[model samples]
Target: MQFLFADCVLDEERRELTRASQAVSVGPQVFDLLLYLVQNRDRVVSKDHMIESVWGGRIVSESTLTSHINAVRKAIGDSGEEQLLVRTVPRKGFRFVADVSEAQNPERLSTDASILSLEATKPSIAVLPFQNLSGDPDQAYFADGVVEEIITALSRVRWLFVIARNSSFTYRDRDVDLKQVGRELGVGYVLEGSLRKVGDLVRITGQLIDASTGTHLWAERFEGQLENIFALQDEISASVVGAIAPQVELAEIERAKRNPTRCATAYDCYLRGLAQMHRGDEEAIGEAITFFKRTIEIDVESASAHAMAAWCYFWRKVNGWSTDLDKDESEGLRMAQRAVELGRDDAVALTRGGHALAHFTRDLDTGIALLDRAIFLNPNLASAWFLGGFLRTWHGECESAIEHFERAMRLSPVDPELYRMQGGIAMAHLFAGRIEEASVWAERSYRNLPSFLMVVALLASTRALSGRQEDARRAIEDVQRLNPSLRVSNIADWLPISRPEHIAVFADGLRKAGLAE
Candidate 1:
């Protein structure tokens, strides 16, 4: 008989256990203990019964039995804390509480909804159940939790559409075809992973695949101590998202950090604010400002809070959402300076605060230096590269600007701000006098973010410079539609340009496209 629960299968006839199609290794005593439990899952098995049946009636000490049981738990991915499959009935014997499916034949089976085929508009992904390789069947809970956390993290990204857990879990019972899963789930990508727990350590393996062509995009393995399992989960989730995004890399900056104040609620509030900040909209920025301020009220020494709040103000300035430029910029500069001072060693805090400083003060040299330090601190930070690239373009380093923008794009191709990266590329081309290429790239950027005034302006300028008069005129209409008060005379103030020639080149397009002088 073959018994299956979660992603693990135990074959009694073969005296074997496999997870995710991989053979698991367990000691003979632990194997017998697990098998006896599954075979008699309907009833509890006492210590005396286990000793007699599995140990050939040999004399077994309480410590010996406890050690073997613990081994069984370790081998299956279960712990004393999380007893999902194995349950201790007070002073009585142990019982298997999980719902078990038994099959006489060895063939795999799946009852969960199988994917047929559907068209997905944006980058869509499904995180299937991770196979538990802890020879012990109880480890299913650990594997399941890991998948859930990954799904949650990915779903937080506004752009990528994530398949619901129920839909993705349908394939948990059996092997699946990538193409069918893609079609049935209406997704472009599938993320498959496995978990293995051995002694004090655990190893996780994840692979991202293009469902349509069965092409393997990326695969990674992570190993860490069980004590830091939560931290390891964050690392894996961030890495998995980074891989799928094609260089859209971000470090697991949170790293299971509990608030120094020992307040979970306060920490949660801070995190909620971070989610809103990443949305990058005027309304969302305002929402984040409120959240971050509350976090400061709860914990006075929150460097991250100060940094993010500083960024909210800077973003407002760049987008022309600020009502009072003087007051906002002053406060923004102070918050940004505080974040930088406090987060001397924190890459996330430094990156955010440094970007805000660069924009608020227009100090290109200082901004670029701080961002460079941020990258040195955490090489996977894509935001730093993208921000620095834009700064470089304004500083008249077009080649370097193009390189940085491309680097950011490669890291996070499916990033929600993908249009911004494309727009930066257009700006670089515009500065370098590659008018036709600039026009093409700008048009693509505008399509992705039609309401973005910067992109609209870019398209207009590039088109006019490239002799695409009609296209340029349409771009002007779009930009003016968003902000009719914008005029060529003041357009230079909106652009973060330092070099006179670069500003002139950009303004020429807007002027030619019929903006008011």
Candidate 2:
């Protein structure tokens, strides 16, 4: 489709923007934003509405938006002062004032005969639940997590259509033909894998096939010790993403490659630790820490193990699970630093280390830079985006923080840690003075994970700030129930923010929400 605005034309099919028949440079995201605006030019689009449509519901900085707007203007030979084509209304939102006309491309709209025939006949692909070859049936969570992670990784590439995990996992334990599976799942590709574990050694084999032709597109064998199970998983995920979307950067692919230790025993322990870490309870956290420590004991150079151990300690400090905060903080910082030093090339390791540094050492800029590098290396890494969001929020760039959080949420759509992302959104809205919007998001966060005390606190504060006294009081009560010794003064210590005004806004909200003096 061709979108004509002023003297420029955007060819959606070619993914190119042009001015007077000459090509103009524009990033994919900027192009998308411009297209969306032009398409919806009839009315004013709110920031939230634009975020959902353009960024795929990921939160981005106001500055980032401004930069894109500037780029769009420059490409169309307009300026902020001119406001000739696109206009930003203060306190409201953006509007596209340009006269736009849509030109159709008949060839571009033509459907593949095979695809059409299949649509009348059957759907295309099915993602089978990976078989847990780990003798311990309890290790099912690890196998399940792998499939989920793969589903998430594959969904990020715009060209590939993926079946949701819920729909894909429905065929668990059922055997079916690849062609039939494809028809059932409505996808052209089928991915099947098996996980096998014997003591410390784990071997995973995966194959990708074009269901329509019943041809194998790619296949690989990943063999590693349990100590490097996480690394192996990362590698497998990256390989699958690369095979499915060849346009992905070579640097990103290399960054996604995994090099786990040759020691099978340590690898097994590490996989066990990974499973426990996903549980995210105090007992599970302790068990994960023990297993990670054991992995490190067997392999002192295991950067992943140290990074996970530090993450567990950081979690403990955040959740008030550890009595010795100073000791935990010191150990977490040291381990995170060591992990970064040893695993600078590892995206996951870098993200964990960056998060630890940001939270424990208050090194916001350094931490953000590390996470950004990690994202550059692996754009599909959800944890890196999550860490970026958290750091940006702490640094008081609420708008940008929201964008990172939204991207992370999109990357891990079915992740159980969704509450964290929702809370991030709520915080951003709270800081932006959209109290009602913050309350709505806070409520969503609470509904998703009721035990999240921080979300409960934020919900109460939002309600109070919005002048809903009764609801605020109830939320405050919920907070007190979760943390019996809660008080207002200690909030500043628990909450991470660089600006006093930000803290003041939070405090005022909480106070109005009926927080204890």
Candidate 3:
């Protein structure tokens, strides 16, 4: 495979790079780095991804990495400052920003084996960080906050493929090309705007561009008071997406907007909590809980805050991150119950709190109902679909669970919760008694998140049941390394499988893998 951009050609088969038909001198590391970036050009590549792919997870110094990046830039007739082709996303690593066209065998192009294609299947748009035109610099946060609100609002539209913020924000503080930005993020439309705040008034100017032809689809300027920021965000998002896909049902966007808080400060706190929560580690989740609690203190009726807080505790209980399991479970149930009681109309709150209540309290019926209502209320809510799928797996409805899981995947193809979704697919297959299919899904999930003990257990069970004794034993060792104590009689204490047959299948597999009964 070869990539052509600007006056350069990068040939992967020959392991060569050229600028203006002249061979460029580059080390093996630099060549590998460039190839990785080009193949993953559809999204921002993280530093961890670079290390894992280029260095084989070996320890490499920061300065050395930066130096290699510079070398790659130079060879491609680009510079770190200009970033014409290679752009560094602060703290997020780098992206190949140039427009690249593939020149390769069609079969090889389709089966790169290294990259997951982000082809747009739905009407998609990326709202890049709104420029802070206020010149105060202090209003940078406000501008970014508005952009995030717009992104969140757009994400709720099921027919829209909204690029995640991290990928869009990679081009921040740089001279942007709308066509190039669209190509890099795999979106059809791009929204670039500026925000200016003065005293108690604010003005937002936005222009929507068709990246395919660099055509201006829509342009608008919104003027409103500081307190009316949320309303402006909703209007801007609705107008932008409405222009792109006129078929986008406005009712779904309205469903998502119903939970917006009256107090911006409380909303800010909730956003901060969310930022911390997405980190997916124990310590970050704890801090996220603190911020969420603060949001609730400011507005006791904040259903989203209550729901997020419940989810934090629920995560702690499930991931074995808490020292006092009983105490945490009790607290989590209380918060989740309150959230469900107050958030009957809010999809976000219902989805999060509903899953927490159902998963932790074993109230499968009510939990699944809440998730069902959430999906009906907002079909675009990917998490709701995924969580609902998991609950269905527990209810022994494998086919229905698989449908919802596929819907979730179609909505958010590159979802950060991909591991959780894959786990749901594994369980769905397990419930259907397809041991081989179950093993394939479980192994994929475990590879994405090795720390997930449940996926490791599934990998062991499926392999053992498929008569792959040696591979099963290796997976069993992983499960034991994650948790030493294991016995068939006590298996229910760890896994949530309720059906006797399903439990027996796992137990028998584990026993076959040399675990004691």
Candidate 4:
């Protein structure tokens, strides 16, 4: 389908958005949203309607919807106030108001078909839930965690569009044809795998297939001692990504490599903990903590596990699920420090450890150095880039922070925790004295995750600073409702920024946003 607006044309089948005969950069989701809006130009689409139509009714917050809206506007040189191309009718919803005309592009369709016929045209891939070949059903979590990691690792490549785990796992244990699966899911490639663990040895087998003709693109068997499972997974993922997207840079391929674990069981426990962490509830966090602790108990030298456990505690404190902030903060800082001391060669451990140190301990210089080293080791480490961005923003390096945040977004385009990156961007904009841009990013951050206290607070303050009094008040009310115990006295202490000016800006924004003492 071809959509023409102004001088730009979006060809959905070709997966290309062009302006003045030149291709422009538009992320996958933004492209999808644009295609939907232009295709249904005559309608007033509500948020629910758009979510159902665009996101296939997946569970996403209002913040996600707003981010897409902002993306679309940014693409078209439009804004909330201008509403030149897309108009928002308040509570009712949105409409595409531009003079758009459908264009017939036989050449574009032919080009798309030609590209589709190519061996690499298999644009879609699904990472099926790995079979728990282990005897104990309790190990199901381990197998599931492996599949989840593969999904996450693969999703980091911007060139590949991965089906979310929730959607892909629907085929679990179902006998289905690859061709039919491809047609149903609208993907050209499918990946299926199995995991078996016995004693201290593990075996993993995976195959990548062209869904069109059921032709194997690549297949490999990974066998290693249980202690090296993490390394084995990384090797398989890096190999697969390299095979599918040959254009991916060498630096990124190395970044895709997973750090080796000191013990296999510790890796297993860490994976289990990760699976539980996704639930984002107090009970889940507790379970995750237990798993992490078990991993550490099994292998105290497992730096990655220790750092991840510290991260869990950090979140528990932030979410108000833990009453003992002092204990949580102290333990998190200790584990992070120990992780760094033990795993100097491990980028993942270093990133998490640095983040904990920077946020919990307020050690800016040491934390920034650690994070920078982590990024240098693995440029594809999205979390490292994210933490680096936050640290840089607080250190008054707004441009550098934006660069890091943009890199993070590119690496993890569909990250479930995208609000964190957006919040970083908002903070950078605010610190750079771009009030309007700050307001935009702050709104986008809040739109992607309403329950994100940091984003809510940032948005409230940005709005107030921008002179949007009512909007600021609304944001403040939302934050107060979300955290009834919130008070001005404790905010500065809780905030991760180290610089006085950064703290002052945040506190001032909150004060102006009408936060009660």
Candidate 1 lDDT over 392-438, as tens digits, reads 88888999999988877766667767787888899899999998888
What TM-score would you give candidate 4 relative to the actual structure?
0.51
Q: Name the candidate that leads on lDDT.
A: 3
RMSD to native for every prediction?
19.4, 20.9, 21.8, 22.1
TM-scores of the candidates are 0.53, 0.52, 0.51, 0.51
**Model 2 lDDT-worst window of ten:** 247-256
The best candidate by TM-score is: 1
| Model 2, span 1-517: residue lDDT tens | 8888788888887666779886665545577778888888998888888778867776566775777777777778889999989998888888999888899744532335434433322233445788887778876776777787777776654324567989888888787787777765556668888888888877777887776667776666667776876776776676555444432222112212232532234555666676677667678889988988887765454667788888888877766677787998899888898778656666777887778877887778998999998788668776788778878887889889889988777555655566777888888878877888888888998887676677888888988887889988998888887776667888767756887888888889888887777
- Which stretches in model 3 have alpha-carbon errors above 4 Å? 1-264
Which residues of candidate 1, in runs, are more than 4 Å off?
1-205, 208-241, 244-264
Local distance difference test scores for all models: 0.75, 0.73, 0.76, 0.73
Judge candidate 3 at residue 120 and give its lDDT.
11
- Least lDDT summed over 10 consecutive residues: which range in candidate 4? 247-256
Clashes of each: 13, 17, 0, 4
Of 1 and 4, the candidate ranking higher by TM-score: 1
- Badly placed stretches (over 4 Å) of model 4 are 1-264, 279-283
